[model samples]
Target: MGILERLSRLIRANLNDLIRRAEDPEKIIEQALEDMRAALREARMEVAEAMAELRKLEREQQSYAEQAAAWERKAAEALKAEREDLAREALKRKQQAQALAEGFAQQVAQQQALVNQLTTQLKALESKIQESEARKALLIARKKGVEAAETVRRFESKVDAHSAVEAFDEMERRIEAMEDKHKALAELDRNDIEKELERLDANRQVEEDLNRLKRELGLA
Candidate 1:
């Protein structure tokens, strides 16, 4: 594994505490899961590298072993031809090849162990990330639920405040309408009084004109 993988494991270890302390736990948890994915990617790269190294070591071991076998065959051929000096030289080559192969054999064992270790670590990290993903879904659901409840609470308050303002506006409008109606009635009453006074003045003028005509005819 690498630094990112190590850091992810550390974050996962303290996930619950981190959630509790964060103001926005939803974002925090999401970022945490993202980090986990990064770690998994890093781990996969390491495993790939280890596999490549293992394969290289295998090839090296096979090459050395093949050289050793070829050298041994050459030695046998030299002996059969009764060439003692050539046989000794071939034997020496065989020993050198054998020694190289032996060295590779030790290294191959070490590389195989390393490959196994890396594979195991990768599997474990993958499992951990999977489990965390499952938990993250649950956390997201909870966050959404909480946010919905809060929205409902705010909406209810907003409606309540709107209703109060609406009622106050309606009452003011009603009061204005009532005052206008009363003012119109009072205006009608004043107009009727003016008409009555005009009627009395016309009647008085007619009575005075009748008296003047009667006096002119000497019947006042």
Candidate 2:
């Protein structure tokens, strides 16, 4: 693209948007600002060169004008001396000098116009550079804010996950406690059944022994 178009794009760029899209926003923003500064410096140099050309043209014009005026005075002196031929020659020289002066004046005017245009462009570029510099801090801050928000989100997610884990652990502990209680009740029930069995077996043995004693005493 043309220089002006490039400059305009650079000047109009949205730094915040750039920062948001950049992978490394600080580095990118700094580089962009530096590029703008470099462009502005180059534009300033161009403006200086244009102004120098304009000054040279102006001096040339002035010199030619002075020569023309001196020739005109010489032509008048010739006329005052009543020398027609010399007067005519002097007039001819004066005409040539006047033509040269007019041409130089035109050139100077064109150079002046170029200088003015370059100066305006240079000023605009400088202003753009300044504006970019001013916004850099704000753009960096915005990037930092985004990063902070992301960090907070991650922290909250971790906290939520930890809470879920703790809840799950509590549920497991409660289930284990209930299982232990059920196991204790089952053990108590088994012990009661075993005691009843033992009592019945002992009574059966005692009856048998009583029968044996009766038989021996002849009371079958």
RMSD of each: 8.2, 11.6
Off by over 4 Å in 2: 1-3, 6-23, 162-220
- Residue 76 miss distance in model 1 (angstroms): 0.8
1-220: candidate 1 lDDT, tens digit per residue: 5444576667766675667776488778777777777777877888788889888888888898899899889888998999889989988888888898889889989988887887787788788789988999898999899999999999988987897878999999999999999999999999999999999999999999999999999999
Clashing pairs in 1: none
Q: TM-score for all predictions?
A: 0.63, 0.66
- As for model 2, its CA RMSD to the true structure in angstroms is 11.6
lDDT of 2 at 116: 79
**Which ten contiguous residues of candidate 1 have the minimum total lDDT?**
1-10
Task: State residue 71's C-alpha deviation in candidate 2, in Å.
Answer: 0.5
Cα lDDT of model 2 by residue, 93-172, tens digit? 88888888899899988888887777777777778778988899999999899999999999988987797888999999
Angstrom error of the Cα, residue 112, model 2: value is: 1.5
